[model samples]
Target: MSTLELECPGCDQVLELDAGFAGGVCRCSNCGTLMTVPVEAGQTAEVVKQRQRPARPDRPMTPGEAEAAAKADEQVYTTTSGREVRVGKTSIPTAQQKKRLMVRTATAVGFISVLAGVLALAGMGVWMLSQAQREAGERTVIEAFEYSPGANPYDQRLANVLGLPLAERVVVVVDASASSEVWLDEVNAAIGAGLTETSSASEVVLVYTNGDGLHMHPSQPRAVARWRADQLIAFQQGVSTAGEGWLDEAVARGMQWLPRQMVLVVGREPSEGELVALERAFEADAAAKLDVVAVDFDSAALDDLTGTYGGRYVPMTREQLVRWRER
Candidate 1:
């Protein structure tokens, strides 16, 4: 048997066929055009090259011819030895080509998804590590203060505030009069709590209103001053002979310290004059807010001061001191 090759007149796509197919009608696999094969192998001439080829006619063949061709279509060829082989068409995809395309697309999408997941996991891990480091630093400070072992609620509360992103300052003023002696322990503890909360850059002032008034430590690290304050508060067996005039003077001096945001006063309620002194101090520092913890006495002046400063007046009893929780 022999074969013949020719180019279609319409599309010029090369085609091969058996000698028996001469003068037979077939479809062009590239353009689906129905054409008559050349009667002689050399009879048909190739057309000139074209950039844009025209589309095939809507009806490639008569209805009857199309039906007859479909009925006879086998899509396979057989050899004399009875071997069969499938034929190729331009528009149809082979099995191997389809598989390769699917594998490449799947591999690309899968690589992108895995890379995104790994990046997200790394970012989360870094954030968690940073948080743990910060907590560890706070815990070390809490332990150095020598408060009761484990988590002290008071220290933890203070630590939260100290960890605030904004800068903060607190001044503690305690009444050191003879009558305030009974509540000294509670006052000392409150002072210690304040010290625990003061960060390295933040400020804590311990002012004792004994005679004229005493600034125990001026602009010093809270931990160092707090220890010294404990010794001072415990030095005298009873309250000193400080009068209301001395208390007023102490408040006036505290006022001289500028840029105070929060003030804690623990002592007897102020007299009218003493109240005026405190009011003036508050006026001087417009941003200052006052919190008063009454030791043994309470008065309308304390209420008014707390109201004006947007703070609360806490009555400090032994039980109340023990039960105190940070708000």
Candidate 2:
């Protein structure tokens, strides 16, 4: 067989083939471009123009070129054995193409990682807010029930001035002056009814207004005593209405125990000097509260005084006291 040398028209690369391969299609070894071999030696090969080939000198075929080459019709040629052989285009990726694919994959993975981190941070913030709210709720419950030791649990009442539950430390100031003699029995009944509701845990002090000062039960300010119905009756039996009493002095003396709440039962309107003295006493103890239960009397000064201290001034009539005692 005669050897033939042909130059590929696509890449100008020289190819050596046998004369038996004349008029047959083959790919150039240097550029992988398909071309038709000539019949004689020294003839230039014609490029098989199945599709426009991309320009890539001294480099591997790009992915686009490889795909185009694969889609082209398969070339059939007769080998030296006289048997027909089929040749199909097969694409092999270049190193640059492999590197670009790896870069794309890494970018996708990095984006997913960042998204997961953001989600985790948002979840943690929600958890922290929930924890704070839970702690605040617990603190509210604890503060609502906080009371002094040995204090009556059943006698607990919400302070109108503080808008909070009162502690076990309580002082009841009764107006036992000559002006309150008419309603003194009703006041004692009301006080006894209230004290009957107290449990053994209660710590109470009864302060009655004397001629010009205040008289406290048990004589000692630091006496830890639980007053019941019997003790309230005994305290009232001992009290005798004589003359006009000093309201300011009685309230000031009630503050000596530093009671959390004080209930004042007054049958007469407070004087200007007494209101001023009451306001001063209230200012002295910011934590202490004064609630006035006015019996058969209502004064704007007394109302304003209780209002200034966040306390309630409730006026009660004879009929109302009767109904309360009956209840």
Candidate 3:
């Protein structure tokens, strides 16, 4: 048996056929096109027939093509196998695609939330550091007024005003007369502050004017001493307001101590006779200078007195003392 080769006219696909089946009709396997086989010069026109193989199921649509077809809605197309395939109307996101998209969206939201929390904490940390720095600065300013151990704000302030480091021979005369009853405690505290600046080798005397006369601690000049609380309490109790105070006598007694510096705590203005006596006492020993602390008392005469003796005059009010004590 001989065979003949022929090309399908519909799709240009070559096919081989038996000579006995010359002029037979056949379908192309490659493209599924049907055509009649041509006859050779010596072959008979047998009009033979051959059954066509069923066209392969239309080539399944590719992923990309299927998506396009679904979007196009009920689109139809001829496949390479010469069969028409109809795509049903289908949404872009199938159940599986929708699930994947939801997971991606949730992950993005969670990441954004975590990032926001981190930023908030960082901001809070910065704010706390700034607050700490601000408080430290405030503490520094408040500490500036304290200069010595166990020293209150009042003591430090008084020390600063008095120009501390007292002279070698110093005398502090406090007025314990009736006029000083209102501010006696403050006067005592002030004297204590003044004594803090005295050196161990320095001589100090404390004098006070009472109804009887003038009273002096130690009765003579001696090295500076820290008075005990009981001693101070006793001294405070001994003050008498029965008679007019001997302020002039007290001043003279302090001057007799021949101190290099004398501090007079006065609660009231001096009388004319007292002033004259003080002037006379100061003139007797011109070398002894005077500094006056006038408690709630403003006296130009005292100011002039301090000026003549080359000393400072400090005036303090009850309100200022109260405020200092509170601090």
TM-score per model over all chains: 0.43, 0.48, 0.48
Quote the positional error of residue 287 for candidate 1 in Å: 1.4
lDDT of 1: 0.53
State the lDDT of candidate 3 residue by residue for 1-327, as single tens digits. Answer: 344567666666456544444433455665666565455611633432222333333788778765554445433333233343343333111111112457788999999999999999999999999898756643433233433323443544322223233455778777777777778776565455554443244567778886777877756766544534456456656765545678788888887778888878788898999999989988999888888878898999999999999877878776666665665
> Positional deviation of 306 in candidate 1, in angstroms?
1.5
Report, for every candidate in turn, its global Cα lDDT versus the true structure. 0.53, 0.62, 0.62
Question: Tens-digit lDDT track for model 1 on 133-221?
Answer: 76675455434342232333354444312121112345556677666666666655645554444443344565666764464555432
Q: Which segments of candidate 1 are over 4 A away from where they belong?
A: 1-167, 197-201, 219-245, 322-327
In candidate 1, where is summed lDDT lowest over 10 consecutive residues?
Answer: 90-99
Model 3 residue 296 CA deviation (Å) reads 0.8
> Lowest summed lDDT over 10 consecutive residues: which window, candidate 2?
91-100
What is residue 29's positional error in candidate 1, in angstroms?
Answer: 67
Clash-forming residue pairs, model 1: 178-239
What does the lDDT read for residue 122 in candidate 3? Answer: 93
Give the total clashing residue pairs for model 2.
5
